[model samples]
Target: MEKLQNREISGKQKVRSAEVGTDILKALAELSPATSLSNLAEHVQMPASKVHRYLQALIASGFAQQDQVTNHYSLGREALMVGLAALASMDVLKVAAVPLAELRDALNETCFLAIWANKGATVVQLQQAVRAVTLVTQVGSVLPLLSSATGLTFAAYLPEVETAELREYELQADSNHPLADTAKYQQHLQQVRQQGLHAVHGLLMPGVDALSAPVFDAYGRVAAVLTVVGPGTVFDADEAGMAAERLKQTAEAISWRMGYTRP
Candidate 1:
């Protein structure tokens, strides 16, 4: 009888734990940006102490994080990894593979496919040139919003509020390296949006120039960035230049494959 009772208790404990975890995740998902402990506890209708305990477990498991300064809770790297794994299996990645390959082959430049995720622009795929140059980044690398061409493509397309939040986040995360003056950054983003492409010449890394264009989804949302990186001498930045035109065309092709119809 004692063994059976213990079994029942164990089952009940498992169900209760799952319920609390689900509630916590649901609350976090519904809250924008990050949620304070008090707010999150209230949202889940749980005691603050109880919520904090669960959050500690979540943090340990890489499912959530607590900002040391703000004490706000947000999803963590493991959550992002899970989402990226699912995104990788999506049809768009499969659809983009061929055109991305063609673009790299034609341009003879290193090509990257970067997707906008919770953390910002992240490189998901890369194809290196036959004679690869000294590239620093790789797949799974996060591009800085104010620096990388891939990140600028996203900054230009994402909503203003989101962009602002991201900018603040970046500033807080990298206090040492501040972004450019606001007016200058805005002007750069304006040009990127107008031209549908952005280029950086040795901004983040010496001897490397990169041109990036956005790929939109069926709903006209910027879904990904296609970036071509090569030596500064070979990667043309002029809008009418062969490399720029080819990059834009390839991005358009991928966008079309993703069901985006030009409006």
Candidate 2:
């Protein structure tokens, strides 16, 4: 019985140590490219002495380094390797699969995930709500860069050059498009990026409303688009609506899992 109690205490101590180590490591990353010992200790809310001991352990493990001259610390070789390995293993489709479904289930609206391909924002996966809508893009369908909530989300996050040629083509195809003027077009895209999501009424399909949000990767690039579609009246794709909030929340959750952190 005494041995069991001792083992339990030891296990608790190990877990507590692990948590502190992880917290200090996170503080190091946040304070990078380099920070003084005092600053790091303050950031982690620990005494300088306690933080230093952890830093020594981290440095020995190659997860941190201290500059000899400046007495500053930063993430080290092993930390960089671990970060790169994690990023390399992150797959957008695999990461987004469950969240995409949950987003649809939560809102009871059709939801889909789209990846930017050479062809443009293309739906790769979909979750249909029980109630049918007039129309929503199916798997493999390429969305219009200017007209779709999904496509506009991509255009908002992607580099202008990446979509410049396609924009001109889309503009020429539909001279009557809402985003015809260059000023309005740029302004609309800017709004989408600022809000981090967008909603359109019958833009993608008549009588349907769509809400779309961007899913970013570790490098802060738009890795995919998550969109929901339903009847205009029932869906009410207002940026302030329930659907919009859920859509953004789910997208952000997936982005977090993908290692994307906003500055």
Candidate 3:
């Protein structure tokens, strides 16, 4: 068995390593059905030779696999097994299930749970409404900090230095993809901070809108974000605000349950 070790590195070193790893993971995940080594290297802006080493490591450790004929890299069986294991071991899901279900029933929308990761925001848990429209994305999904309502809400509630670092990462991501512009991204973060909630429409999908609010921990710090998503045809601006308010109240309730108290 390959030993997986977590090395203690400096903050700067961690940033450099995680940035590279995130880029690679994003490339592989985006490729999904089919992806060649060269294609992944170009997507992540890394040399093919260097990326080969990373791929080899991933394959040897069962995080990824190469196709027999097409020579494409896809998520390995171990990756799926690990993902399942993660779901099984997630305490947050167990803790948030009943409350999230209640929130979903109250709002009649799809509820999502996301946590902060070194790369960006990682969706750890999910509870969908029976009558609500389903999202193409699901739990274990990783979204960029700038383009996601949950990410923006988390950033809005983060400390100054942490937010600044996120701003830099967003700008860099913007430079790579024309999908998200830097100036507008800055404005979006500002809106999140000012409004105490985020209601972004047509950002994730063509006809979807999401409203999110921050969930605090016992320390009064943002621990996670709770969001509700719905189709735009059924959800209008007013509905968005109502959902945001409801999500905010639900998040606060969860925070209080976690022993968070404001001075």
Relative to the true structure, how large is the alpha-carbon lDDT of every model? 0.84, 0.91, 0.75
- Tens digits of per-residue lDDT for model 1 on 57-158? 989999899899998999888877975675555566777888989998998888989998878889998888867464666899988887788988899998
Better by TM-score, candidate 3 or 2: 2
Minimum summed lDDT over a 10-residue window in model 2 is located at 129-138
What TM-score, over all chains together, does every model reach? 0.61, 0.93, 0.57
Model 2: residue 253 alpha-carbon error in angstroms: 1.2
* Clash totals for all candidate models: 0, 0, 0
Alpha-carbon runs more than 4 Å astray in model 3: 1-94, 163-170, 176-190, 237-240
The prediction achieving the highest TM-score against the true structure is: 2
Model 3 local distance difference test score: 0.75
- State the lDDT of candidate 2 residue by residue for 238-259, as single tens digits: 9998888888999999999999
lDDT of 3 by residue, 1-263 (tens): 12323343455677986677657765786778769888898888889998888788778988788888889998877777865675455455556767888888887778888988876688887877677446666888887666778878877787757766766767675666432565765676787767767887888777888888887765678888888888888864343466777787888787776656654
* Best-to-worst ranking by TM-score: 2, 1, 3
Answer with 2 or 3, whichever has the higher lDDT: 2
Model 2: residues with Cα > 4 Å off, grouped in runs: 1-5, 132-136
